[model samples]
Target: MSQQVGVVTFPGSNGDHDAWNAFANDLGVPTRMVDYRETDLDGIAVVVVPGGFSYGDYLRCGAIARFAPVMNAVREFAQRGGPVLGICNGFQVLTEAHLLPGALLRNESLRFHCDWIHVKVENRSFWTSDVEVGDILRLPIAHGDGSYFADDETIARLESNGQVIFRYCDANGAVLDNANPNGSRRAIAGIANEGRNVVGLMPHPERATDPLVGGADGRRIVTAALSALQVAV
Candidate 1:
């Protein structure tokens, strides 16, 4: 049976349809578009918080949406080992909800950056099952408040726990200090929860799932996720 992935749609969510099509059509999986206001969490194996200006990106990208009724259910679902993926502004939401560690702030340049970026898989987290360590891929990134921040101890803790799942790199695959784009420490681009069931990243992988447009590297991620559904934890 195909894995069922739920894509949450907030008031200003812009990537819901794209995420849905990627999982359902491109990846051949069952997917549903869910409203953020809904409370039920039944039958959801995987959840995706797609990118956009949820709640108008006011008072922080995800501060407002964190109180959505569905998030409480989603939090419980995550605690039960359900897979969750957050992208772009969704990444901010995960942090705001404390699902993932660290917080996203304004870019170092204090500007919104939208373009293709190079990312390297740094750890074998749930979202990176098909991505081997050191593997690099290009994906689109569109966000303003994406500078990842955390205390010194927190950064050390994440590193020691193998939670840092992805990092930004140059075209040569070398870590570019301060090219950290979003002022993220250690050039971190993505990360997974300690249990590895939840992941959040700034880049949009769904947008790169087709060769017709640019690349199909993202299919690997969706396919890997389906495989995770079959394996009993």
Candidate 2:
């Protein structure tokens, strides 16, 4: 059976449609756009919190969105071992929801960055099972607040637990020192929960699924989630 992925859209979400299209057409899967107000979590194989300025970035990147009914449902869904993927602002929401650790602070440059970035696979999280450690993928990142920050102990624990899923790399997939685009600690571009069911990243993999659109490495992520569903079944 085709896996059904849910693409969540908030009041100001701009990537909902794009995510749905990429997951559905490019990946040859089925997808749904879940409203932020809904609270039901039935029959969804995977949930994607697409990138956008939810609630105008009020209070914080995802503070307001965290209180949304859909997020509450999403939280419960994640706790049940459901696969949840968050991108850009969605990453902020996951952190705020406490599904994932760390916070996404404003870029060190304090600028709205938008461009293709190189990210290294640091661990074999569920969202990156198809990705090998040290492999590099090109994906676009468009956000102003994406610097990941956690206490020293938490950082050490995350690294030790193999939860750090991605790190920023250079053109040749070489890990750079302090070359982080957003001052993210340890160059973390993405991470996963200890359960490996919830994933959050600052890059837009959905936007990178098509080489015709600039890159195809993005498809690996969506495909990974699809693989998760099969594992569950």
Candidate 3:
């Protein structure tokens, strides 16, 4: 069975330790911090790219982090069917790496958002496997460029392929304009790659793992991924 999770840390990754705490400390799972300068992922079971303004968000969020030496290993790991989860800025990095499709533009409101939101599960893939479709997940999002955009063709493709994994929705799971916090297209908050192993989302799941912090819904996502990967804690 898979053993340890690897959390990648870029120059400005503020959430690396948060993620490490979630898996290693909170979840009681083993974890390692993968430095961006390192080009290897030797024994890592699952990979997580946490959030932050990598490379100072230079050029664009995740643009520079996409070229980090560690990302090359991540790409290779994905090619080997490894499960990879990217959160917030990590999501941006995956898109910039072409590991996923589309781009995240500035929020439609043009303001940074740091709020709790609801998302409905659209598919059972990788990081979202344990959640049933249409289930409402309450997670926190913190990003200035979380708006998801893609050409109509690409959007349609993702929709038809069931690549859309999470969509902004009301607390009761109703997808509506007001619930679309970042104005993401079709309210998409997360998605999976064609392989269904690479997943990225604009929410911060690691932060919600403990009750003291708020809710434990993010714990659901993490444990779900671990369960799906059959990685015992």
Candidate 4:
């Protein structure tokens, strides 16, 4: 049976449809569009917080959305070891909600970045288990506040725990300053929780799942999540 995925839709979310298309249409998985006001997550095997300027990004990127009724359920779900993937602005929300470590600051360029970039898989997580370490993926990123930041001690902990799942890199998997799109510390692009079930990233993997749109590298992530959920069942 196909895994049932839930895609959260905040008031300002713009990537919910894209995520639904990727998982439901392209991957042939069942999907539910969850509203921010909903308080239940009964049948969801996996939850995806898609990218967008939630609450107009008023009081910090995800500060407002963190208090939504649905987020309480999301937090509880994640605490129970459920798989949760946050993309782009969704990543910011996860940080603000304290579901993940680190914060996302404005791009060093002080501008919105929307383009394709390469990211190297650094560790295995539910979202990255299908891809091998050092494998480079072509993914599109669109965000204004995508620079990942954390205290030195927290960074060290994340590194030591193998929680830094992906880092910005060149096609050859070389981490380079020029390849860093948002001046993220250590060129980090994505991370997972200690359990490796919760993940947050600044790139839009759902946007790169279809060949007609661009590349299909992102299919690996969606597929991996499905595989993990199946194995858990």
lDDT digits (tens) for residues 24-67 of candidate 4: 89988778899999998877889999999999999899999999
Index of the highest-lDDT prediction: 4
Model 3 pairs whose backbones collide: none
Question: What C-alpha lDDT values do all the predictions have?
Answer: 0.86, 0.89, 0.90, 0.92
Alpha-carbon lDDT of model 3: 0.90
**Positional deviation of residue 46's Cα in model 1 after best superposition, in angstroms:** 0.7
- The candidate, 3 or 4, that scores higher on lDDT is 4
Off by over 4 Å in 2: 1-3, 231-233
Query: Candidate 1 at residue 36, lDDT?
Result: 92
TM-score of 3: 0.96
Ranking according to lDDT, highest score first: 4, 3, 2, 1
Candidate with the larger TM-score of 1 and 4: 4
C-alpha root-mean-square deviation, each candidate:
1.8, 1.5, 1.6, 1.4
Clashing pairs in 2: none
Question: Candidate 1 at 69: error in angstroms?
Answer: 0.7
Summarize candidate 2's per-residue lDDT along 5-120 as a digit string, tens digits.
88999998898888999888998776788999999867678999999999999999999999999988998889988889999999999999899999999999999899999998
What order do candidates take by TM-score, descending?
4, 3, 2, 1
Best of the two (3, 4) by TM-score? 4
Candidate 2 yields a Cα-based lDDT of 0.89
